[model samples]
Target: MAGPPQQAEGSGSAQASGSSTARKTFELNNDVQVADPSDSLFAYSRDEERVLEDAAPWKKDPHYFHTVKISAVALIKMVTHARSGGAYEIMGVMYGKVRDGVFWIMDAAALPVQGTETRVNAGNEAFEYMVNFQTANNEVGKDEMLRGWYHSHPGYGCWLSGIDVNTQMTNQSFNDPYLAVVIDPNRTVSAGKVEIGAFRTFPEGYEAPQTSQYQSIPMDKIEDFGVHANSYYPLKVEIYKTRLDEQLLDLLWNKYWVATLSQSLISSNRAYATSQLADLGAKLHSAPLDASAKLKKKDEGVEDDATPLNQATQDSVRINTELQNGMTAQVIKEKLFNGKLDAEGARKAVLGVL
Candidate 1:
């Protein structure tokens, strides 16, 4: 996936170089296809911005990347594409220039890769697509280089998984300034903000700092979330826009507001809701509810000072509280959106003359 980083990376060049006879059948003015005959190297450029070819300051700093600035268009495209995936994961790549500690993301596009709910690894086919898409952009007069990848976590919130961290690690291990981005489409819908995170891996063997999680994650996905939480750190993300972008966003919101007001959270994420409840049931069934669930020795029991909260009890309360907040938000949305519908027959009767 594109920047902020949590998707598999692979080169598709070898697979793309097919027989000339096969290539003859598909060549067109629009250069993108199932494969590239030449298997051309991607145009990794630093053309638009001021060059720092000699200075390699980032290699020395632990927190080299302080911010990631995504174009307004890129942000919208990523969010909409992530939302379209529903429960399944989706992946894409970003085109930009990484200057100093900031990643100036000019654009983003989805890769032609099939992703399951938990995994999104770009295969050879995706590499081909990446090359073709980059080529097409150049033809159309847009020439930003591939800066990073982004993938969705669906309902699990925007944090890199173990897989994501590994993928990002492999990517950056070979290539400096590459980034990883994760998006949570379901949380975006519920929370009224694009739930996105940008990350860069530490140099190998470098220990890192870590997150007060931005949103709720499914229990099934939390372990991966926790395991790799410190392998990389997040960047401050900001969205940038020009005059045309401002107009485009205004037009989008004009059309989007209706859907925003009408959407039901539970309907949008029924699978997540069911999965959360199922996980809670399983967790409760297997884990002790409290210290009372186990027999205590007389010496252990009478430690009279109010027993400080244990880790297990604190976790259960947090999970329960977050789930309640989610459901409560859903109920509130339903009531708010159906305000007119809840009115008695007098309002309906008044309209009958039409």
Candidate 2:
């Protein structure tokens, strides 16, 4: 995992052959924009570079030649994770030569882990981790932030599926530019045979997708380089736990108890009010309840004298209760027919069952 492959780039040029594509260039000067700047999921820093973790020969699908930059460490991590029968995740750093309209992946790195079933959904946790990594190392605001994400498609080939598009859309919708990478675990083999494809959620009005064949990365030649040996092995304990905790916290904050509890409370209150209103209406219509009201009033001789606050509170409760019992008015000529309901519409909508 610590060595480099002899070949680089999409061309068949080997490092030993002295081809320009084989030479590693670390110069930083470009726009490096993400696929969607409005996305909230990930930000891109076209300038940041992560450590390459492998020495294996890497190949890219021809279609993605201008779209991604596979760094030495990023490629090694991918091979190591693929070799272990586990899912791998990539923090893809992007580079865009604004004049050429093409995107390059300048850096790709991952936190390796072992698990029975690997989930590689690129969510906020991954974003925060990469962002923090950049910040702690004083690399924040260098060039790009969080560009995109890469994950293995397991035994699946290097093509984006409908589900894959949907998942990537989830990533892209985060108001940041992001792309999804699919590596064919089964297709990755000795030397230069690894197949990889990159994708981004295209904007509206784009042409429909083509599903005829697998998208394949081109192989120019085989070469060797350097990698971090530890990246090729199982991830260390601290890194694994740290990533796991971040993911767990993100899930809890975004998904669990608080949101559910608030929604539940609103629903329960609406239901209770509806039930109370129905019971009150039924009691008014019943002969027995009618008799009790008269008798109780006469016996107590109180004339139901309640204070203004108490009476007002009762009226408010009854109105809300009636609303819960399905009381509503129609809109006429684009105007609300009921002024009371219209004035309180916002409050009522929030209070009512949704």
Candidate 3:
């Protein structure tokens, strides 16, 4: 029976001098053997070692990073999921591959997790689903990897809180080159723009890099996020698009434009009221008849003396009504053009109003 395997020459010294305290303190149990001295049990030729090294290159230093690319479909899915959550926060896992030092996100899976205004928690079900998804997709040559995760902030805006930082650190420890994405659906809608961020956390005790290479996100959105911003670096995102995606975007653009062009009933009413008040003021100021004469006539029991004011008020109301009708006609035309309303439906709408 062989005793404990002997360490290679200078191997113990190298281990002692290494900067990683965890690695320096690690002890192999009785079952393991050092491969250098073994012939049949474990062996590697010099050339074979070189080939293995070439096959699996060493990972870059923890501070270094690569760009992240997301597919348009994946982004659309994330945004749709965030929007569906409404006031509550939502989270999901991202699946993709890392190639040529870039993280390319190709797909996403929504997780059925408990969420609140500030936090999200994934249970055992989420892990099971993730494993099943990875297995199923990998079998079909998808080769999907659990690259990162995304969450929504709802009304708060897109930024990582302290809890988010801790979560990201754990993920990074489990999987190097991990990413964190945050989306603010409410802020997106309110600002009429997408509020999203991609970040890579620094290794423990290392300072995060700060450079303008990343995409420009609004500072206002992240002003109050947390103090951990200095511990992570924001990454620029590129949405990959295909021909099919372009066509879909075109259709969506038309629909959105039509909806935006349609005036709301409340706004139309407000505009009409404002215009009527302005016209009434102009008429009252321009009248040449003296106020004293009108009062004297009123005292003399002239019943029809106030008829002009009433006529002016009636005219203002009629003009405002016509303006509102014209606005409605324009909206109908827009809806028909965008296919939201068919030609027959638009015609019916106009005729019914008439």
Residue ranges of candidate 2 with Cα displaced over 4 Å: 1-66, 85-99, 111-119, 122-125, 140-143, 190-192, 204-206, 209-211, 214-354
- Which candidate leads in TM-score? 1
Ranking by lDDT: 1, 3, 2
Clash totals, every prediction: 14, 41, 0
Estimate the Cα RMSD of every predicted model relative to the unseen true structure.
15.9, 30.0, 27.3
Q: What is residue 50's positional error in candidate 2, in angstroms? A: 21
Quick one: best lDDT, which candidate? 1
lDDT of each: 0.70, 0.39, 0.63
Q: How would you encode candidate 2's per-residue C-alpha lDDT over 48-109 as one tens digit per residue?
A: 22211011111121222134444434555665665556333332333221112233444455
Evaluated against the true structure, the overall lDDT of model 3 is 0.63
Model 1's TM-score against the true structure: 0.68
Point out where model 3 deviates above 4 Å.
Answer: 1-59, 139-141, 209-224, 251-256, 262-354
Better of 2 and 3 by lDDT: 3
